[model samples]
Target: MKLSFLGQSYEASNPAIAATDTGETLTFRGKSYSQKQFNVALRQPTEELTYRGVRYHR
Candidate 1:
């Protein structure tokens, strides 16, 4: 379940998007991703995300 996010590459396991009073944020492992630059990864996936100008897929 390799995924491509933005345009860069990364490895994610059981990734999840967490939203609070601030905004939306992608969290996985021990890292947190808040859409900034374009990035992608090849490993595993828990979901497919595509919103506004952000894109995450396998």
Candidate 2:
């Protein structure tokens, strides 16, 4: 069985705020997000997945 959760994506919406580098940060609309969220959304080119804005990578 596969369980899933809803998440946000960069494609449908333009986050408006953005950042670069490890220490730096980004924000979707006004909510703050981690670098992984930005990377997975903008860089990886992978399918949509759950991103809780914590523990960016496994």
Candidate 3:
């Protein structure tokens, strides 16, 4: 999956869910997510992900 925020982009394959001081996040592909959006993304299906006009899949 690929996610972009604040002009920064991150890609993760089989990302892992984690909890942070603020809320939940995901850690994958060397990036750590501490944003609510990332937590919501965890519920997304693995079949497809669209970020920054690009599509990703497992």
Candidate 4:
């Protein structure tokens, strides 16, 4: 899935927050995101699931 956070875009096969299968870090837009960022992103009301084109919280 493709998602945008903090003005950056990321692609992931799984969208679940803090998924261990995805490894310890998530790389997006040439940057690596740590668990804290992942948690923050998951908590954000704006986080979206690009495949479904809907906000994750809603």
The lDDT of model 3 is 0.67
**Global lDDT of each model?**
0.63, 0.49, 0.67, 0.58
* Residue-wise C-alpha lDDT for candidate 3, range 1-58, written one tens digit per residue: 8999899887866646654465768898999967553242254555677879999984
Which residue ranges in model 1 land beyond 4 Å of their true spot? 1-22, 36-58
Cα lDDT tens digits, model 2, 1-58, are 3344476333343334443557657888899956632333444444544568543431
Per-candidate clash tally: 8, 0, 0, 0
Candidate 2, backbone clash total: 0
The true-versus-predicted C-alpha distance at residue 2 of model 1, in Å, is: 29
Better of 2 and 3 by lDDT: 3
lDDT of 1 at 28: 85
Candidate 2 overall Cα lDDT vs. reference?
A: 0.49
Candidate achieving higher TM-score, 3 or 4: 4
Worst 10 residues of 4 by lDDT: 35-44
**How do the residues 1-58 of candidate 4 rate in per-residue lDDT, one tens digit apiece?**
7999999887754445653434468789999876543332243355545556654542
Error of 2 at 2 (Å): 14
Q: Judging by lDDT against the true structure, name the best candidate.
A: 3
